[model samples]
Target: MGKGGKACDASTQNRAAWLHGVNDLRIQPYPLPPLGPTDVRVRMKAVGICGSDVHYLKTMSCGDYKVKEPMVIGHECAGIIEEVGSEITSLVPGDRVALEPGQGCWRCDRCKEGSYNLCPDMEFFATPPIHGSLADQIVHPGNLCFKLPDNVSLEEGAMCEPLSVGVYGCRRAKVGAETTVLIIGAGPIGLVTLLAARAFGAPRIVVADVDDHRLSVAKTLGADQVVKVSFNKEDVASEVEEIKKAMRKGIDVTLDCAGFEKTVSTAFGATRNGGKVCLIGMGHCNMNVPLTPAASREVDVLGVFRYKNTWPQCIEFISSGKIDVKPLITHRFGFSQEEVVEAFETSARGGNAIKVMFNL
Candidate 1:
């Protein structure tokens, strides 16, 4: 990699990647493009294996979005700046940074209003045609790249992607010092939501998951209470009742990171009157929500797309030691292209893994 006033020999051919179909990913050589004036070239160091990556690998799609053609498959990544564009002033060679994969048209009203995550023309990485950061190097707009503090490692820097989602969820839900928060899934996002809620000063936090291992992780992460749900149970209402009994008087806010019908129902039933439900998971695009009853109780249902303007706060939270994400990284792999594929497979199967990360 080029850095520190020295240029390493450029590869004769760049290593490009493609996802041919479900369960089929291939890496091949291709030509690298020269940096644009507003671009920064980075050598990827660590990329976390996300659930969306697993879904695309196993089914070649996520919800309605499908991988119709070969596409690169990663977005959560941290890297070292190998080259900088002419107009870039805040970064240079050798700077360690985290990449924000979503690129939106700056002319849109959403972008101008600081809600670029909702931009209709946003081109996000690893979401079909748009290439991601799984390869050896990537060229991205300089502004989307976030500089890391001296105390944060590259692996931790990569976690800022998911952490931003948690931060955004908390913001949307308006979790506060007296709020009783219930997180409906104990996956990375759910657990991170718990951490964010705690950092936001929420008084009580309860987490639920079908996986015992994940619940254990949530307990370790300081969840006030943990509920284990059975997927095979015919009546999830009883399970919801049990969780409510443990939490006492239901919760003030519910965050559904599972995105399943059962979990959504549970959230609707368990959330106290006038509470909020934040939907963060993408399990089903169109599931039946208990809107009538929720409305009668004055519940506000909120939806979260990607995060906007949250990376800086997440980075600051991690750097200040208010939130610890090191324990969330349950597994790690080398940066080899093959290892990246394996990590995604393991994450998809969901066995004894919490957060799988790739070290480049």
Candidate 2:
């Protein structure tokens, strides 16, 4: 245990999966930090493997955040509250909750302005030095934890992380009944965005991807149309026309879940004049595209970085049955040493798996 009091009874084991180096993971005992006055200790029950987690396992780095030291690996998670600090009042022991991985410095201007996701001093779980929630227990802020409704499972609660991204993106793009949406990429993020757009009353949605299986998944998840595109740059213009033809209408909003330059270009070219293109995927650190053409057409390209206050809306969407995320979870593993390795591999391979989960 770390700080004021011991983490639960010292007798119980607190095992966690840690990433030591590239492609190396070890399950070992972890120390629970002493709870602060506003903290609550959570006993993790479910964790979902994210694409960024796989990136760290494969390269020991995710964008600018690198694993300079051994760190626990997970961010999408839900758990039962085991204990609450002296000043904690919103949660109690036995309360099932979804953990929001990012905690902002409330003192920052961005945080005060309700854009805490953009706070420069944010500490997100499983990023660099911050340990994640894929463990026996974790000490977290009560404010960052949200209580799940009676119908919501721990696994569904964990799904909220990805769903929050989709919800936030849709909100940012102002999708509505009059808008026709074009979603680029049929991966997990894209699929969630499709669900969110539909829930937000998008009249028509067309999804494009390089994989047939993923496109099929998008179709099953309420996408009005799915287009399988080629990897050839020379074929992009024709593909965009095909996509627009499939929609049978101009795209009022485009959500690029695949951050490749090719997808961004397709989005810019396919959207109607004065439409909005929101970029959610982080596939490329730097991308070069036709900015002048998009500008001339009045098409706006927006960038997304994680999410802000979206947990309650995500839970409501799940509980109300507006969006079902359970289908996205294709593989599940236990928290054993070998199982952890397999989970990471399945997520990294990314063939049929949309979301790989850990059943703790």
Highest lDDT scorer: 2
Judging by TM-score against the true structure, name the best candidate.
2
> Measured by TM-score, how close is model 2 to the native structure?
0.97
* Candidate 1, poorest ten consecutive residues by summed lDDT: 1-10
Against the reference, the lDDT scores of all candidates come to 0.84, 0.91
Q: List runs of model 1 lying over 4 Å from the truth.
A: 1-12, 232-234
Report model 1's TM-score to 2 decimal places. 0.94
lDDT of 1 at 308: 90
lDDT of 2 by residue, 1-360 (tens): 232122443424788898899889999888776678989989999999998998889999989987887888899999999999899888989999999999888998999999999999888988877888889888899998999999999999999999999999999999999999999999899999999999999999999999999999999999999999987778789999999999998999999998988988899999999999999998887878888999999999898999998999999999999999999999999999899999999998899999999999
